[model samples]
Target: MLYVLVKTKKGTLVGNYSSDKAGCILGRSSSSLVPMAGRKVADEHAHLEERTDGLYVIDGGHRAGTLVNNVRVKEYGPINKDDVIAISDYRLQFRFVRIGNNEEDSFSKRASILPVKSVEEPSPVNNEKMTRWREKIRRSLVSYMDLRRVNVADMDDDALRIFTAEAIDRIIQDHEDIDSEIDKDELARQVLAEAVGLGPLEPLLADDDISEVMVNARDEIFYEKAGRLNKSEVTFTDDAAVISAIERIVSPLGRRIDESSPMVDARLKDGSRVNAVIPPLALKGPNITIRKFMKERLTADHLIKFGSLNKSMVSFLELAVAQRKNILISGGTGSGKTTLLNVLSNFIPDNERIVTVEDAAELKLYQPNLVALEARPPNQEGKGAVHIRDLVKNCLRMRPDRIVVGECRGGEALDMLQAMNTGHEGSLTTVHANTPRDCISRLEVLVLMSGMDLPVQAIREQISSAIDLIVQQSRFSCGTRKVTSITEVNGLEGGIIQLSEIYRYSQRGYDKEGRVRGDFGATGNIPDFVEELRSRHIEVDMNLFGGAQESEAIQDGF
Candidate 1:
């Protein structure tokens, strides 16, 4: 049997393999036997294959190639016992013991050779001492706060971090005689993290693969990566640590969460959406959910790469936007609704002025003339609340070339429809629903919520005339998000809005690895907007709407 022992910042990692097998690849790929999902590791970085004589290591042509015993290897080489390999920032020690040899004896012999801790779990006494050290660091921080006469509200982040580091150093000096097993750098990091960052969430948030971070309580944390939820080993020290982290998030934005008002929605500086619920309303201690925002603005090419939409779909959507069709993107929560809306909005002409309204202000439009408006929650006295409806109504008077409401969750849907009906032709918005037909019904319900006291038929007529297209975005159980349907609004018939599906996603069942297996195909229905597009001299290739091969050959001819 052969195995590799790697030392990470988190802990010691032990990956074992049988020498009789072919080989075990090592990289950040999910299929790799030992997946190193760190920022420094490449996608399919390196491989280890077993041969006739002995095991061999082959460099996977990584830009940052693998290292053996402090020297970079140019090609394949034989693996020897007690050899150290370095990949990215990680250092791994190799061990090869015959299958019949005593495993326990080999582990003890090898463990002593490395500076890192053994792969075995930490003792309870060590855990207890670490907890005590964390408390001493917190107490020292409090003492420093009092001695320096520092106000948390007034101090800048750099100043606060300096004080925190000094306090942690002092605590380390005071406890030097107690134990030397504690990683002082890590302890200081934890103290600073608890003070300024989101505590245990800092590392999870830094991981690019993790899309969602959920903190059920102080000690229980889970994160969603690649559309699957997994329990995270990271956790807060106590309930107080969780509460302190929540306060750090909402305090800067003037949002409050407590027994009086225990729920708030805030966003990080990088535009990641955050929702926190504490005590009273929340049965769990302190529940926090964070949806990470992508730093790069995704365009049509990116969506096509993700299989969210094909080139034909992109061409049709681009033409629809250029033809000034009002688009309503409908989907359930976390279904990539806003992302699709942003991509479609990019199809609009750069010369036009765009006004965007949102509760959290997440849209990143590249147009120069963009008027971004955000809603405000009322204060403790229940005053000064600016809602989506108010912003929608006011944006009309701003002479916007197009009005884009982030998501119509309330009465704002009425004002958005009216604006689209009057002069705003290329307006865009999103709604919560499962299908395109359900989106019209949802809009009717939202219009009724406007307190207009209008007839149901009147609202139906308004919706049918205003919305030209409904792009239904859906997030599958496997965590892949795609545009499930693109339906054209053919106006109201028999007092009900009529819809025709132009493109639909056909699911072929889940793949072996559990990823979504589907195809985006046209419904063979020629859209009514084709004539309008031709009238405006917008050259939309007809071959794009054809079958698979036809569409693929000239999908770039838009």
Candidate 2:
């Protein structure tokens, strides 16, 4: 006889099931017994059976679906005995205990063993035990004040004591249960060690000094601080715990990762970007990377203040957007591509209808006429999935004045370029490329992924005509992300696309603090749309193209 403990929303049931006599227990509830031989009943039914290593299954009935750990299960499958299961509106949790085990039975247990007269033999005793057990469990739980005292006493040192206390407070506010005892001291110590290990990298994330976090396993956790890679001492307990923590973080956000699905990309509440992968694909235990965002959305003024761009350069960009120029922000990964895109998007009119698409929705637009769309992963059965390309094609019918793609990574590049050419002017997007020249090549490669057989020249022609400006940004060694070049496409010449730099960042000498010093300056060639900015009463400084003296003067004021 196998003793089973079943907990459901209505109550609790302590019963036993025999595989030989019942074939398999079938019922909508613990009280109902339906045979499992008929086609309808066989297709949809719930039952429990022992499996190796403490696992069981609560199969779904035909009309009602089964859920494991609150996640809906599409078919019959193995589940751990401690797993929480849900069927339709009701939730059930199961635990398997061997009869005559040495451990003392919980308060919920009725007697040593109930006689198996029928399936309903223990019904009366089950009800009495559930009520008594709930009260006992409630009293055994610890209070928040007790947890705070315990965590404070466990602090090993001064620095850790302060950090642990603050971290514990944050966790308490974030978690739902205050009465549940979770060994707060241990939790606090672990989380504090995690934060301290991050070190200077923590300030970079909070200061908005960095834009991306890259971790190549536990030994190497790097962040793009000030547009350059900065190494930090962030370490995890072990590869297994790192994988477990990453899974815990992503799963709560409606995402999953395991051997079956080894790769996952997710976003944090603050719009930080996250990507994680686990072994056998990873080979390492599990790898996680996060790209932190600025607490405040960067505006044109902020760039000017940071000396990344001058007022004249800002004026030129503002006019370029106002004139409906299709702009592509190009950079390597973690080079502030999205940050620059967000800053430039501020120039978009407040009243024009806009549509933004991304794999994970991270763009924060202040425009009232904005609609954000995100891609969806397929269900477990590999159905009901939506891709970025599908969203791009559908955006065409949405009557958008501006179409903003958070990033063009796949076949959607072709559709986006087509959208730009077909009157979706002022469309803004970002792409990962080493330089402006590489951006065109990346677009061509992505267009080919669409399965379109257009010639290379035709693809280049489409790129040149569709994109008016390429703003290249990079993270320097000092961890600064600056707009390196703003080049205009001068159309195709000699079967090659011509690019002329309108603005460029000239490297000046480093500052007193040994940081990279640079100034944004124009190259003196008149843009095709110079008259458009002139119409807006925005003047360009001719000396901006002359020499370092003018650029130096502009930097001193900042």
Candidate 3:
């Protein structure tokens, strides 16, 4: 059922509207299906079209702009439930509630994984005297800056930190009521973090060992190191302080988060992915999760050292990429799919033109002839939005020898496969799947998601011809991620796509320390394409095939 919630400046009203065969019009005019009342609303502001695949909103070419989730959009659809629609002076929660009756699959039918939560860890510096001293220093710092009419935003970063640190020092020394036993330097750092940085998160962000930071609430902060979760001993002064830190992270990006848009996805200047959730949905408080990007670029040798794969696997991947064989990296979340994709990307020779497309620019490709395109979120006015599918389609015209997509999450899967089949061969991408067989099924599902009316057999044929290899990277329960298997997309026969496993990881068992005990071995089954294209100057070490005759005979009659 489709539900429409009407919100005015005075209050909110719960109501329902009947859907017409053509579509529903949301505007101020009485004739509009959902007659919005406001001066900013146009007579026919936007049209909502419900297709078999999903619901889409098309702008009526109005200058005010049509919006979804506070994002001004010209034409966007498949708007999932729980999404807020903003028009002129009105806000509406548009939803299609399907409560477990799976008569048909829809947005609400998909399962969701909630953010990780941990218990609050008390700060070691959170003493009564120290808290008071820090609060005093913060107040004094604000007064000093205001008296001098200092514009923190305009000041150079280096100059600002130095100036703030010195001012904090002066505030501490001028006040004798403050405890001397308190580490003055640490106190100053805390004050500075509160004043100019991400409050308590500054230290975690600065630590080289920390990979992920989670803020469940003002007092609950957790971090990840070497795949182990540990609660941090620091926190924001309050919920408001937590919101302030979020603003600081997003302000430079010209992004805003508030009641209308309580959820946001962003990245730090260093490319670390950051996500924030605020009130209404986030009951506890403002929460932030930051996944730090690799500071040092990793190479294939690094993967070898990390045991993500062996020398033979890396050699085959390097050759596969160089030979213009389209490769897909498959894994679950946090399974190091992106890391492996990044390492394998450098395998592309510097001489070729490379195009990288992503939702947020993360791939740090060093190729001189590289064109990076990042998908853009809708502007505040709901305009100027670009999606991964559009980027994948447009990059084809850019004459790139290799197309590196950061990840394929939607209809873009169809376009990516088409690109690989149409001569842009050495393209690389990552997909969310548990195993190589599941990877094939996942691709089929994603391709069908494109809303193309093609038959299943046709899609299977496209997959078999388009993709050459699949590298299955997995994160074991032991908090370690490594390549579990590498398979070949041999061909499609009957109605099934045939797969041959080239390399596989055999896990004997977990060691005494709980670390995964596994070794990588080669599957004797070789790719038919390798044998057919032997004359193409691409060399494959035949000896590597003697280790194991890996049968991905798992899902193929094709």
- Identify the candidate with maximal TM-score: 1
Model 1: residues with Cα > 4 Å off, grouped in runs: 1-132, 151-154, 177-181, 535-537, 549-558
lDDT of 1 by residue, 369-392 (tens): 888998888888779889999999
Measured against the true structure, the TM-scores of the candidates, in listed sequence, are 0.75, 0.61, 0.74
List model 2 lDDT by residue over 225-337, tens digit each: 44456665434445654676576557657777877778888886678888888888887567778887666567878777766667777777887898899999998876778
Local error of candidate 1 at residue 251 (angstroms): 2.6
Which 10-residue window of candidate 3 scores lowest in summed lDDT?
109-118
Tell me which residue pairs clash in candidate 3: 72-381, 72-382, 72-383, 73-382, 492-558, 493-558, 496-558, 523-548, 524-548
Question: Model 3: how large is the Cα RMSD against the reference?
Answer: 22.5
Ranking by lDDT: 3, 1, 2
Query: For candidate 1, what is the lDDT?
Result: 0.76
Of 1 and 2, which scores higher on lDDT? 1
Runs in model 2 lying further than 4 Å from the true structure? 1-235, 238-240, 509-514, 532-558
